[model samples]
Target: MAVTLQDKLVVALSSRALFDFEEENQLFEEAGSQSYVQLQLTRLTQPAQPGVAFPLVQKLLRFNADGQHRVEVVILSRNDPVSGLRVFHSAQENHLQIERGVFTQGRTPFKYLRPLGAKLFLSVNESDVRQALEAGFPAARVFPDSIKSAEANPDEIRIAFDGDAVLFADDSERVFKERGLNAFQSHEAQYAQTPLPPGPFVPLLQAIHLLQTLPANQVPVRIRTALVTARSAPAHERAIRTLMSWQITIDEAMFLGGLEKGPFLQEFEPDFFFDDQTRHCESAKYAGPTGHVVHGVANPR
Candidate 1:
């Protein structure tokens, strides 16, 4: 018999995504790992400030509060072993029960997601996030400066996602980008009955759905998910149909068309928001913790 994450919703997080490490990161960038290691060592006893994704992680860990082990959060970082000591210490000081970690020094840690059975990966490193996405994992590069989640709704875990190029494949997004809005609307209208292809975040959504299906008393916190997309009216039908086809229920769906998503998301008050386009993510950061899913047509290199 072995300890298993098979039945858990596993999330792999980078050190920087979990705590405020900008100053140390800057040292690592300008002065290299040695200086960074020294700085982390000196600050080892001081708990780092919570980063953008901190609130979300706190709520997610609540799933395990019922003593069922329904959720697992692991530190998968590029920092060396010495730097990792500070990360663990910060988690302890912050009262987060994060117990597992993998310190890879300067190496990319995305490859470890598979063995960990992680459904989601959140990191501050763009290169690592991109690599995770390319490898078919739902990953996002967290905005370090994004607004923190509100203290209200302590019992609920609110998460929001962009529709096209995030939860759904960017086929419609490609059409919209290449042709005019008329063509994109027409395409979606014609295929209203057809289920849109799944995107990178689909696995993460399914995992959440699974957690939602668990007995209400088995999990300490409630999960509320939303699809906040730019698609409107006629095009929205297909996105709805796609989720119906997958049998996944989104608690809220905002068809914003082309309006800015920031205000709407602020009202939604999600613990975290994910969007493929940097523009949407930029707007969303003002609302709460935002992650840049640098995938699909909008992220052309």
Candidate 2:
């Protein structure tokens, strides 16, 4: 029988998002691919530091122990095939159980998400992230320099997501962006009984929810999720009702009302946080690992 990833929690991420390739990336930017490849070859034995999503990926893979493979992480990168040797070498050095990869050599890698059945894509390139989201995948642009989550809890995995344009469709966000806050609130108020449409990250949330429902003895690690959004009060009602409709219950929810999310996120200390706007991503990174969803009307062409 052919191998399949349909049952796995598939995540495809770029080399930059998985490990710190900033120095090599800068080289590729200034001196071109040849120089970058040569440098990588020379330093193939040196393990690259973990990137922003490192903690999250590391913690998630922990679920695969005890003869179970619940998670699958792949390297979907634009690096040339020759340069990819280093990526695999680094993974090996770090003991990351990643065996699959797609090196596009220069092309957009988002095209392969369909074949992989990937539920999430994380890349350092904004364009790739936008392309993936446009292709209907839950994708995010990771900040390579963002502070990785402190490993305070080894037996649990914590994740957080922005509400609109993330776990829920950007309907309210579109209204807010085009008609201002008052109209956005009123629109949500008028339709408080109606659940917001599903967004790209819903599948991810559902997957996590499934893991949470498993008996504690069945899984080695605990999973906790939170809804961190800018919506508050009347607008917050629609977001809550939407989750209620889906029958998914998260551990926590925050409606900051245009306030900085960084401080609040710090208290939660998620291994990773995903948002759809640059402003929030910037602030959230300081608290923990952060990624930009790059979706909805907020990221219009």
Candidate 3:
């Protein structure tokens, strides 16, 4: 039996995560788009090349309508070398396919970019990805660490997020960022065991959480979550204690203090990462897909 959309697993990829674009660009320009697409299609169909590491993107040339899942490749620039390869692999994968033609002058044609059907396109920047997602296209990055192939079951769609501002109130964060470290520490200390107000996205979190907590036979599809944040060591103890106090179970937790979150995020491979700060989101986006930013206490200066 063919898998339905709800039963199928899907992933969307950005250009940079898919292949070595800078080096391939020169070759792509030399070969021209038409020839390059053909060559890529040929390579995708061949068995995995020897010496290739894990997370290798194999190419496919057919789309399976019954599955309802599809691959979309958002090409950021005209010179993106990964575009052709993405298209080639989509065809071979039997996933529903959509390709936004080159955003370049030549403009390569793709089968899907329609609003009504499954959405797929090439995004040039963070704004582009945001707009497409807002417009209903599922956005994804191509980093190897971003995809948890082992844990991902075809029957479920798993999504994750950070706790503060994303699932709970951002007031504490606002106090910390504006008042300085000491003030922030004091506020947390006062509220040490106290429960803070919930954030705007709490309802969404609850909905997903409800689905996750449902019986396996009742829901048939699983949804998982984790609390990946930068609050570490001593400060981390509070957040951990807070979650325990609330009786919430976070699948994973990382209390990285002032650390670049890309590496750890690659391991989580969440479908989306939502943060109030652009700095963290900017780096996180490179490792995996992200969702709309939820405002925190401090406004961007």
| TM-score of each candidate structure, all chains considered together | 0.98, 0.97, 0.50
- Model 1 ranges with Cα > 4 A deviation: none
Off by over 4 Å in 3: 1-156, 241-246, 298-301
lDDT of 3: 0.48
- Backbone steric clashes in candidate 3, count: 12
TM-score of candidate 1 on Cα atoms, chains taken together: 0.98
User: What order do you get sorting by TM-score, best first?
Assistant: 1, 2, 3
Candidate 1 accuracy as lDDT? 0.92
Instruction: Rank the candidate models, highest lDDT first.
Output: 1, 2, 3
Judging by TM-score against the true structure, name the best candidate. Answer: 1
Q: Is candidate 1 or candidate 2 better by TM-score?
A: 1
Per-residue CA lDDT of candidate 3, range 112-177, in tens? Answer: 333223333323234444444444444322222232242333454434566566556677777867
Off by over 4 Å in 2: none
Ten contiguous residues with the weakest lDDT in model 1: 62-71
How many clashing pairs in candidate 2? Answer: 0
